[model samples]
Target: MPLRPETARQVDALVADAQSAGHVPSLIIGVVRDGALAHLAAAGTQPLPDADLQYRIGSITKTMTAVLVMQERDAGRLALDDPLRRYLPEAAAAGPVTLRQLLGHAGGLQREPDGPWWERSEGVDLAALLAGFSVTKVAHPPHRVWHYSNLAYGLLGGALERVTGTPWAQLTQERILDPLGLHRTTYAATEPFARGYVLHPWHDTLREEPRTDSRAMAPAGQIWSTVTDLARWAAFLADPDPAVLNPTTVDEMCAPVILSDLDAWRGGYGLGIQLTRDGDRVHVGHGGSMPGYVATLAVHRPSRTGVVGFANSYGFRTGGIGPLGHQILTHVLDVEPVPTRPWQPAEAPPPADLAPLTGRWWWMGTSLDVSWDRATGELVGILRGDRVSRYAPEGPDRWRGVSGVENGEVLAVLRDEAGRPAALDVATFVFTRDPDSEP
Candidate 1:
């Protein structure tokens, strides 16, 4: 009743593959669907068969921190748009950086100031960490682009402490971990912590390393948790409990704020969350990576499916956990695979002879090349340099795609004073036509 028959087999195969490749000393995977946990599997050893321990969850800590901030906001203690200086005056002189900017990684702060603390220092007090930020310069104009910064969250942790008159770690436990009944999850410094491990480059050997304490950057990454505990966290993300954070606020946290096109794994970043669309359904969650551990938690809200995967070894790389988790969810839901075609705006008819609508349009910073089929008197919209779709006129300036995923999707064309197609607003994407484009 927990997992679909085939899904259990698929998970078994994945764990076996990881074991054979020595990618992970141990792994724990959990899947939840329709408000209930479907499966929880643990394989391998915590410390090579001698120690039974859980792994550090690296950057996944940020997601928990983000949730705490939202909880405070829900209680009317603070606002997301409040300037960092509003909470901590030390940041006032830096510039106009807001808590929203910090959460979305748009604060223009460096990824990690004072060098990599994971490799360098044991731990630093909040005051010492904030002191180093004085000389830290902005990398870009605020909110101009997406730049992952651990330090920004670190500063956010300080802001929370200043606002609440408590330490970041305590605030998280009181606000999130404790209320959620995440008994097995706690700060890395807690008792029964798992020793971190790194895989040697040359041979099939894993070396146990001292666990790095990120007290100063605790907001960025500093939490230890087991797979079982993460399963509950994933469930909360998929269908939030209003007592914690309102469902709408959770959705807003997972909504896209910036586009990440720098790599093959292109997606959007929300407030401490990542947004990736799998066909019509959007997956929301976040991934974590530290020196010796990698973890990913994602949820398909529409399907009420969530996956949490954790690895013990540091060098273990599985591309990204989000896609893998999504694949598992699809398999469970029996959903068809997502096509590689990029989403495009709907098409519209030309006002006169199908001439006025034949042009390029930009929608939400994405362009869709549109042309008129003179012979058929239809409109075609091409997306992502490929994937052709045809549209038939439905109304004055609205058209509906006849085939493909865009089929049945409506398009509304915007016109300037001259009555020419200047912009196109599709179901959700907005497109602005190229000026020089001719019909």
Candidate 2:
């Protein structure tokens, strides 16, 4: 469905104001909902960009690289805990650094490769990168802190190449880009791309910035993408498609590995994704910045609403274009909130074996209610009124908590002598049919 005109206008005003006030040469944005582009808007100087115009999407490339790595993990080709040196022996210095560390920026690697600035200048191959890499490159002990590392991704791409026997670009193209139908997203710039430019800090004048192949560092920030394609990608991140990547693996990737902004506690880094908070909503996404280019992709997983934005000017400070992109996401949610769908009744009941487990129980002398969920086909535990958890059978007389409290913990069934249902033992706490029963 199209956005309400009032909603569209409000979002447009935000875009126009950002363009005029920031003096950006060109800016474009796309609002995504349920893996579809719901609206698009553009504003800037003369000749505003379209949804298809590509912009260098800087470190957002890391998100894709992280996805690819997760794909390998799912396929059993690699594990997150596996040491990097197991694949790339050259980096024996950070030998203990695991793939998980590289994806989460917890590898303690130096921020950039040693030599000149590769963002503007040409990048070297993995061999050249490894030659300069030493123990010093492992600046801090693994898991010390969240240190953003372009070098870590470079090493990941190298490791991926060796493991899969496939080129990084080709592997990404086949695995992620092509499957998602992101035709406008590419490893290299295409024609009619947005010319990246640096807007003078003091004046509105623009200077074209150089674009170069990141080579081995391509996995770090070499992607060039359009707002439309990026919006779709953001939507995918919000609600992953099982055909491309396992949704569960994506969940693992979004789990906070460490907090990025410890004080505000508003920002964090996941296995590979970036987590940001605005008011009460948390977005799973990443921002991109390269010379003369700024871009962002943020998605609200609950609402599955997202925004992909790009600007020709790389003029923003530490945040780059992230603040604006995040604001746009928040705005869309505010004015064009997703409509609620009517709930449907279940067509089938839970398994017959679970029939005995449903209904009232008691835990720690507190009343507990248990029911079967038709939607997820799991057992739901409601304790003390509000604590809800979903459980799935793990073994005979045992069920594992799938979500909410006691997640991943086993709920062992204690049967009566007659083999009828009795009390449940979970974490030393027992649940019985009698609410008055004391522990």
Best by lDDT: 2
In terms of TM-score, the best-performing candidate is 2
> Measured by C-alpha RMSD in angstroms, how accurate is candidate 1?
10.4
Q: How far out, in Å, is residue 267 in model 1? A: 0.9
Residue-wise C-alpha lDDT for candidate 1, range 1-439, written one tens digit per residue: 3775666878767655655565677766677776666776556765432122466777888898898888788889999989888887766655888889889888787788575454335778787776645635578778888888888888889888887888998988887888888887878645555555787777857787677777878888888787667777888888888878898788889877777655744578888887776666677888887777777787887667788777766655554444556676666666423224685664754556467666667654556888877557678999776877888889888899875568779878878898877777777576765444333
lDDT value, residue 140 of candidate 2: 86
Per-residue lDDT tens digits for candidate 2, residues 148-199, read 9989999999999999999899998999999999999999899769888876
| Poorly placed runs, candidate 1 (over 4 Å) | 46-53, 189-193, 262-265, 317-323, 335-439
Candidate 1 local lDDT, residue 40: 66
